[model samples]
Target: MYRRTRRAVVTSLLVSSVVCGGAVVLAPAAGAAVPAASCTVTPGPNDTYVTISGEGFTGPRKLNDGESTVDLAIGPDGTFLVKRFQKNVDYTVLAVNEDQNFIFVNCKKVGTAATPKPENPQNTAPAQPGSRRDIAQGRAAGNQAGTAAAAKSCTTKPVADKSGQQHSDAYWQAWTQAANRSFNRACHTN
Candidate 1:
């Protein structure tokens, strides 16, 4: 005699557990199916700033270079820009986007991979007290301070002098001189 039997079996993986830094994280049973998020890396002026733009991201986002990380300010449209990003030499940047349900990782290389050597090692000496570099830095600082002072002193914006429907070189020169005088007085006066 032969007897037939039926059985019910559950074979789906309900949840997955991952151990991270002595912490156990239970994965979600199910989530919405979506395409992986990505970002574009663009090197800015002298490779000092890096602009990252993309879409379709949620939750937190950041840029990492293994040792340090910078948080990205994501807009409502999912685009981000990293102004004044300090690029590391010989390193790959890791762009991360973390949502409640998933984590997206993207790797990119920014700036020169090799360390740049000074063209003239002798000329790479530190800036002296009255050196050109020092003067430039001082001038920059003074310009910023003076500009703020001038702006605060003036009730309205300074307008450049112009001829009838046209501006001459002399007029521009005079205008610049006046502005320089104003700034110099504001910054250098005791």
Candidate 2:
């Protein structure tokens, strides 16, 4: 009976043991439901900095953050494993080199799928630049600037005194005044 109990205990202890370099690790059970896969990014060619982070994962996974260089595992299949992360969140390189290298994200979810709300309005694509939707929504990158520039463009340009005729003082003065008026209308400048 004692031997049976000992064997039971030993078997229970071996439930989650992972052997690495003659060491044993008792990993936590995922509690019946399988966890989600994670997104990962490596520094592409000419990338001076890179990182990844998201739900169900630990601290920031980074290659650099302007503080110091990071030792990144850049294998075709990286050799490190932490807790899993969720899928479909923007993975950005928070703070990176002055010149940014385009980041490419690749991941596969191996477990339960992420459920998104049906017909979510905010899930629609953002307004196109300079489109009516962008201007109305105040999301146009040049909304205010474009309006101000249009105001300037609407006024007719000043006619220069390039008619090589010798003009009297009164004629030159009147021409200057007309030019100033056009300038005021165009730029709202006195």
Q: What are the per-model numbers of colliding residue pairs?
A: 0, 0
Q: What is the C-alpha lDDT profile of model 2 across 1-190, one tens digit per residue?
A: 4335434433433432322222232222446332332455433223333234333222223332222223333333323332212222323221121121212122322331233224646535555554554344432222333344436674544444436644344444444454555456557655
What Cα-based lDDT does every candidate model obtain? 0.44, 0.36
Residue 120, candidate 1: C-alpha displacement in angstroms:
13
Measured on C-alpha atoms, candidate 2 has an lDDT of 0.36
After superposing all C-alphas onto the true structure, candidate 2 shows an RMSD in angstroms of 21.0
Pairs that collide in candidate 1 are none
lDDT, candidate 2, at 176: 48
Q: Candidate 2, TM-score vs. the true structure?
A: 0.17
Q: Residues 64-159, candidate 1: write the lDDT tens digits.
A: 444445666667765555543644422222323211323434435444445343366545444455555544444444455447657676543334
